[model samples]
Target chain A: MLIETDVLVIGAGPAGSSTAKHAALNGSDVIVIDKKSEIGAPKRCAEGVSKEGLKKLKIEPSNRWVIKELSGVRMIAPDGTSVWLNEEKVKLPEAGYILERKVFDKHMAMDAARAGAKIMVKTLAKGIRREDDHLVTTLETMGEEFEVKAKIVVGADGPESRMGRFLGLKTTLKPKNMESCAQFEMVNVKMEDPDSIEFYFGSVAPGGYAWIFPKGDDIANVGLGILTTETDKSAYDHLLEFVKNNPSTQNAQPVELNVGGDPVGGMLKELVTDNFMLVGDAASQVNPLTGGGIITAMEAGVYAGEVAAAAIKDGDYSAKKLSKYQERCEENIGVKFKRDLKVKDYLQSLSDEELNSIADAFHDIELDTINTAELIKQLIKVSPKALLKLGKLF
Target chain B: MIIMKVNEWCMYCGECAGVCSRSLIEVRENSLKFDKKKCKECTICIQVCPVQALAKEE
Candidate 1:
């Protein structure tokens, strides 16, 4: 079959769905393709987002998608020292929700469908090419071969993006710069506080951290992200060990397991080229410091869709025309992501003692007083030269 | 037992190392080293290689 569209979005995750929805709403014929038959099955994600951050994305809080409303976060050091921060009391730092990602992604895709975008599930983008002014995307939908032609193609195919690779774009994250992750959805969990997401740092995760995000009082997502180059053991092994020994989650029953990877190198130097744009984990737009990509993916999708609509209308699919999306992203979100990568690097270098000291710095401070300036003031006042270069994060 | 083989196309991306339950694959600055005892032959590392750098050799 032959299908033609103004914009073709490859991958129907939160990123692709938001792009398709926005492009269609902005007067472009859009089609979204996903390799999965079910839009959001085989769930993966720590599933934590801040209330304020969700509001900034303009997505209404829906009971259908949210598993739990996260009100606070607690970071635990190797020696068991802890620092807690509440989302509601913090002004600058962002925190949001624990979502059922399968449902959240499905709802987003459905909203795109409602906005007049055609969705092709179980369809994979096999190859891509440029013929004259239009781009042709070769596809295989559930064993059937097909093709799509479009003026603009958005690649949202996760960390190992093949669409950009098909174009010979060649951007990649180094093994050391990527986070290999493993997670499990568990029931009968014993969380110290159901409303607070728990983060444990040190060798348990080896250059990363372990997280327990409660879906309910008795169920939670227990996961961890380890630098791909840090250790020879798989992330799943680390997660299994964490579950077997951790004080709060030791006795939980594992109900499901998921493993994945994300690039933590910030945005790819070039996410847009002639007639093509990459969004979400595919573009490496995740927060390197937090290893979070859900919100950033949608943010990049919005930008990609907006640019695609305008570019389609103008009949100019040149790299120069589409570069506006990169500029918009850098100005609004890219700068922070770049900054976060540096913070992650610095945090990785700290020893257990340093980490404990940093956690202790926040011991007496209230969440309301945890803004950057205040934190910086507190750190400098106490340990001034101790953090040195890393202190700049505050 | 499952044994996986690496091809010349290995990107040295450390994916094989990242997925191995044991510390089997060692990613060095310029090459990769595989250990027999550490490898359970599960073949998951082979399946997840993005570049098809790995193959199953029973």
Candidate 2:
């Protein structure tokens, strides 16, 4: 079957859904397609989002999607000393939420549908073609193939997106920069303090860290992120090893397991091209420090929707017009992400001993008062020799 | 029998204990104590031990 629309959105995750929601609300005829039959199936996330990020998108905490409200965090050094911080005092007022991601993502898509966006699920986009001034696509739906024509195409297709690749943008990620992760959803576990999230940083996880995000009194999501370049251990291996060794969680019943990666690098130098735009994982908008992408992806979607609407109104689909989306993202969200990457890089450079010592030293400090940069600065203040090893990355 | 012990440097934060599957370890007297009999020898404890204290019995 052949269909035409004002805008075509690929991959109905946060970015695609939000883009469709905004465009449909503005009276643009939009269609979103995803390969999955269901909107939020086969969950592959840590399911944690900062409070400030959700509020920015105007998504309030709903019981259906929110499993718990997180107010503080605990950092465990390699030496075993711990530092705790109240998230609010740190200026992350909405600090974060341990969400039921499947529900949350599905609901976001529903919001778009309610606003008049037509979604095509279980549809795989085969390839793209440029005809005259329009973009054409051949999509496979439920064993059958179909063609779609649109004036504008938004690629929210995620990490393995082909749309942007076909348009000639560098989509390759270096092993040094990518984080491999694995997690398990556990139940019947007793935590020392269930309300606070926990982080374990050391060489064990390599460039990344391990986390325990409490979902409720007895349920939690435990995961780890490891730098791909540092080790050959798979994320599942890391997660399994941690589970076998930890005393607090050793007694818990294993319920489910999750594995994935976080692309902690910067945004693509060019997320837009002639008549095309990228968002979400496709655009590499994930937060470099935390490997969180829901907030950034949604924010990117909002900008893309607004830009695509304006472009349609003016009948202009050139890269020059879409460049506005890139500008808005950089000014609003990109700046913070860039800074976060710097911090992430710094953290990645530390030795297990150094991480433990830093944790031990900071045990007495108030967490809410220190930004990541300040913490690193303090580490430098206390140890001049350590700073020398960093070599001016600061 | 593998005897897993959390390092004295550990704060009993239970990050490793919480992710364990065999229910072999527990926090007692503000330190990691274990029951090696129930251990499935998964070694999640060794990998996530923030203090690098947990070690297999020789």
Point out the worst 10-residue segment of candidate 1 chain A by lDDT. Answer: A87-96
lDDT of 1 by residue, A136-252 (tens): 999886568888999999988876566786686654556666677788899878877888888898888887889888897799999998874677676777888899988887778
**What RMSD does model 1 have?**
6.6
RMSD of each: 6.6, 12.3
Q: Which of the numbered candidates is closest to the native, going by highest lDDT?
A: 1
Cα distance off (Å), candidate 1, residue A88 = 4.0
Model 1: residue A53 alpha-carbon error in angstroms: 2.6
Which docking class does model 1 fall in?
Answer: incorrect
Instruction: Quote the positional error of residue A76 for candidate 1 in Å.
Output: 0.2
Model 2, span B1-58: residue lDDT tens = 7676555655443434334444345442244567777888877656543334566765
DockQ of 2: 0.02
- Candidate 2 is scored at a TM of 0.83
How close to the true structure is residue A352 of candidate 1, measured as C-alpha lDDT? 78
The per-model DockQ list reads 0.07, 0.02
